[model samples]
Target: MADFDLEALSLSELKKMQKDVAKAISTYQDRQKAEARAKLESLARDLGYSLAELVGTATKITRAPAAAKYRHPENAAVTWSGRGRKPQWFVDALAAGNTASDLAIG
Candidate 1:
């Protein structure tokens, strides 16, 4: 590494140098990460598995189907899984003084 007289440098020049050093470090870190990832991928391929599979990130995420938790009173076809936001029908029923238990599916 080259020695520099940092104390002799003007404040503006020091700031510019700092910025340049920061940029260089960032670029070097990015290159290192890319190289590491490439090496991992190569090793994974040699092991007969993809990078994601080797990391256990390639597994398909599956969820059990949502069961009908609440059914519309007037329309049996209309249903809510009661997992997320309440449906407008459920809200309307609540506004009209119908309890959530009133719409519970068997």
Candidate 2:
């Protein structure tokens, strides 16, 4: 590392150097982690297994969106799958004494 003449540096120069040092320190861990990941991936490839396969941390399997189970009383386009939270229209319909079976798509 080059020796910094701290006493010779002006206030602005010292502040700039401090900022640069802080940035370098902050990114050092990220750089190290990337390098380690690359090495691990290479080793896993040579061993005939992917890193995810070995670690069992593969991407999650997502299901297709649920089929619409309920339809809006007035709007055919507005529908709900009946899986998550009820929609405002559905809530209003229920409050208006409309049973859930009344909105069934069938």
Report the number of the highest-TM-score candidate: 2
Instruction: Give the alpha carbon lDDT tens digit for every residue of 31-85 in model 1.
Output: 9999999999999999999998867675688999899999998999999999989
Give lDDT tens digits, candidate 2, residues 3-95: 877999999999999999999998998999999999999999999999999888857899999999999999999999999898999999999
Q: List ranges where model 2 is wrong by over 4 Å.
A: 1-23, 45-53
**How close to the true structure is residue 57 of candidate 2, measured as C-alpha lDDT?**
86
TM-score, every prediction: 0.55, 0.65
TM-score of 1: 0.55
lDDT of each: 0.94, 0.95
The positional error of residue 69 in candidate 1, measured at the CA in angstroms, is 2.0
Weakest lDDT window of 10 consecutive positions for candidate 2 = 52-61
Structure candidate 1, residue pairs in collision? none
